[model samples]
Target: MPGFDSEFTPITRQRLFAGERLRAIRRRAGLGQAAMAARLGISVSYLSQIENDDRPLTSAVLAALARHHPFDLAAIEADQPTRRFAAARAALDDPVFAGSALAADALARIVEQQPAFADRFIALHAAYRRAEERLQMVDEGLESGGGRLPWEEVRDWFHEAGNYVDLLDRGAESLALRLGDGDGALRDALAERGIVVATNDDPATLRRLDRADGRLAISAALPPESRRFMLAHQLAAIAFAEPIAAIAESAALRSAEARRLLAVGLANYAAGALLMPYERFRAAARAFRHDIDRLRLHFSVSFEQACHRLSTLQRPGARGVPMFFCRVDMAGNITKRHSATRLQFARFGGACPLWAVHEAVAIPDRIMTQLVETPDGVRYVSMAKGLVKASGSFARAPRRYAVALGCEAAHARDFVYADAIDVDGSGAATPIGISCRLCPRADCDQRAFPPADRAIAVDPDIRRIVPYRL
Candidate 1:
């Protein structure tokens, strides 16, 4: 695996008023002030001062806590004043709070003194936003006279579930471990079950399994990585049938078509999990600093598969960096989308044309990188790669699409593509919106349409890049 070289620099050294977090940690560990102070090699009065917000937790105290406590130091660090301040600031960018947003100092003070209240407010705002988006999606479906499309229902099911299926992920990882041995592990496992695997070259379907005949065939049209993925998909269909059915049943989807689609999606997820088990893949990703090419090479999976798997590493207490992943076709349609970060994809139509993913779609086999700031002022480091899958014949058209993976700029350290971006440098990041109809940027030259919620005024006498004034 390839790794990047970097200078070790601290993101911040500001005074952290983490009294509430400190107290919570101590209480959770059932330790008194004196006991915790002793463990941290600090005076009881100093510890008391720190807990009471009179003094900040010094680097030495943080180090001591890390060395002595069994808790997640990273979690503790993440809950500090800086992160809270960022979250509160971002949440306040919502248009609903337009004129009544708090100042930076006041927000920081509130986060320091009443962290729980701040958290609840952010959570409430988030839920309200989700509701609004869902309503918008429903409105679009109704306008189309589709009455809530089954595929959209299935998409929302995955989106609401955070794109990380715990039961399927765990089951797949267990199966991967049990298969044992080297490169031929999957094939060996199938052989043990008296099944023969072969290449079909039919191109009609990706895979076909005749259970009664103990035979399985994968399309030769697919590349090697996709072939292996299909193999894992077949394995999941057999070994995880019950769990997949249970998950689909519990989803309470509106249509039988939706339930069937959910099952297929779950099976695909299980196949990815089996091909690249969670723990091993996450460890490798961290080690390589999330280099997509290296990850694909190491796991013998496709580029899109590596990126998709990276987006799903959201296990509790062992989460990977929060990321957003989407696949866009040449027509600008978002075929697959998931976000573990603050960024969300457009629910109904095409994505922002300014997004690098759209550009990637025109130029296959090359990776594109960009530093983009959303309309809400959140910056992200985005990486996109265009790919074409062969149909194994000149007459059959190939499949062309681009997959994008990104995380907040704050997580630039863990993302390989972010090395090209100067996180602290002064530059105007390319401004983008979720979608044309949802975007608030009135000045965007590439905006195909005005925001759906806002009224547009047309002046026949005057003309600009956009036809109407928003």
Candidate 2:
């Protein structure tokens, strides 16, 4: 009674009859016109008028029908001329429909006349996007001359799984509990299985596993964290052999090489999980407010390891703030990527240059933070730090990369990097796009290419920062 208004406003006067939706609902419910009219608390003649579009449905009748009948009101509302016309117009704006641009009235008429065709067009556009991504991957493989390499297949497999392997995670957590925490405990566990763990000063080999001789060799030149990670990776291979094999076999990869790479990836995932147990790490993350430095010190893991572990904190009931993690080399190639958030990385090219991750490359060891907004209007508080992994010799160059971690603005309160920034304030956020080619912004000077979905206009007399007007 409180929500239902007795007097209808002028806005309600525009109500058009959704006779088709009403008839469909009635037929699905298997109710005759008389019974439907009785249930809706309306006279049979009035119901017939509503069904035949001879009368518009009023507020009182709509409320009565909602109270008595089970129907999707949202679906019925979407059938309104205004909403349907808007959807059709948005679809027409797609680059696929570029050459055949229709006037607003024309598009609206099409939606009104052929709604099924419009819906199918939207579905076909979505399918086009999926196919485009696959094509990009194929092109990359061809450029590399490897014909879709095994490592790329494994990477795509992980991407499809949301970057979290539940079976491997749980198995690793159980193994960690049994082996206990700390490097000493891990060493003792390995030793008990007749696997002698020893470190060698030779920089040529990072890690070597001899199964027949039951010996594991690690490089002494490597740092404590790296050494520990390598040892844990080996332990995963030995301890969870059956589970890892089952997961690899179930993948049904085209080549044995891909399956082997997948097994290694699963082992690496297991090693990360073992190094930082989920519950303990999540609680510590909350306590530290997700400060990467403090987390690395507490867990005795490297900065990259800490960030990678944070991305995998997607357990069922207990979960951490969803974050996107990525590593970009000096060449701007994204070597690793995973997102538990809505933010998706560009599959083909480098990340947006305006992002803080690129800046981190110039300023090593310092963590850079920026509040960035995507083209879709979602804001993220991103943090990045440049790292150099020494090759332990002057003859070889150190591996240079910048690791980036971020979460959506909703999780800003939990992220330490967002502490200094005002996320809610206007004009304080940096506008970033998914990629230059896919971005819709026209005036961006940093844009390397024009948007694939939009038309460009070039004038010799009128030149701006960008040559073409989009």
Which candidate number has the best TM-score? 1
TM-score for each model: 0.78, 0.70
Residue lDDT tens for model 1, 141-252: 6545656578988988988898999999999999988985343787877787777898897986888888899989888888888888887887787789899999999896
Off by over 4 Å in 2: 1-147
| Model 2: ten consecutive residues of lowest lDDT | 1-10
Give lDDT tens digits, candidate 2, residues 72-184: 34335533544444445544544455478664444544555677787787678667766866654555445456455687778888877767888878888888888786888
**What is the total number of backbone clashes in candidate 2?**
0
Best by lDDT: 1
Deviation (Å) of 35 in candidate 2: 53
